[model samples]
Target: MRLAMGFALITLFCSNSYADGYKLHPGTPTFQGKHFDIDIQEHCQEGEVTCPDVSYDSINKKTGARLHLKGRVMFNPNNYNFQGYIFDNGDYSYVLNPNHSKGTESVQIWNLNVFYKDKVIAFDEGIMQ
Candidate 1:
């Protein structure tokens, strides 16, 4: 019942979201993790027109470091079943991979791996709904 209400609120918040790019106001639907808390909003770009890209604001709980990584809704053939909302910068990356569809949630599971050069420095998984 609670999950359904959450999904309903998610639906209400996400309805008609792409008219001027993805705009998640105030970040109610957030990725809650132990070491990181991430939220997303519409990526504001310079120019006359609005961008359809999305940006993630991630905060490291331990160090209080924040990252404003920008990316878009990527569609990969291999990851067709998942939400390919992915971001990468040099050796650092944030990928929102899928777990399994419990119902109709877009961001149900998260898989993030922070890389330092070639090795992964941190890995965290959490729920987003």
Candidate 2:
């Protein structure tokens, strides 16, 4: 009985920790046949006040070139749900959950942007408008 209780406690703790991590799974979008795999994680570091880390990874399908992007993101105090990132590349930025008209519509669309060289490489969840 004691072992079972311990296991239950451990499970709860793990789930709680995971709940604090907000992740966005950007759908696969290829550029010039070079597939981009993105894994965006917004989680707090050991000494960070909140989830200030915004990072992503991309792998080239043809040449196997992997690009890892790291950025510092800020959270809005009035709206804790909104966050944005500016990557170390200096030309790239990603805004998460931007305020949009569609967001208030029935569909509840989520807006995510990927910029390169100050130009938007990819934007919006579905079709770009």
Candidate 3:
């Protein structure tokens, strides 16, 4: 009985560790523009995103206070495909995909944004107007 109990506890602990290994630091900043918050994620060349290099910030629109986190992504002129997420304090999240794909006729780019209030509002692909 003692051995069985010990084994069970060990198994439980090990499984939990492997369940979800990725952790985002809780240092997310807050923005005060109409009382809003924003989150941004950008993907560049591999092995480029690093701490004190790939972070976000909150800018006060009225006061023009640039409160931001320092972060940077690897740059490759040949490759233009990138993907990431942005969470806005207005209860919304955005998925940003800035890429240009060569095609037979024309190139294509995908951009999306989601807003949550009483319902979900989706912003689809389109030229910035």
Regions of model 3 farther than 4 Å from truth: 1-47, 50-82, 98-106, 117-119, 127-129
Q: Candidate 2, residues 10-124: lDDT per residue as tens digits?
A: 9887765664332223453322121333455545665453454667564443334566677666666775544544555666675444346654544444455667876778764
TM-score of 3: 0.28
- How does candidate 2 fare on TM-score? 0.41
lDDT of 2: 0.52
C-alpha lDDT values of all predictions: 0.64, 0.52, 0.42
Q: With candidate 2 superimposed using the best TM-score fit, by how many Å does residue 99's alpha carbon deviate from the native?
A: 6.3
| TM-score of every candidate | 0.55, 0.41, 0.28
- Which run of 10 residues does model 1 get worst, by summed lDDT? 16-25
Clashing pairs in 1: none
Report the error of model 2 at residue 96, Å.
3.8
Q: Rank the candidates by TM-score, best first.
A: 1, 2, 3
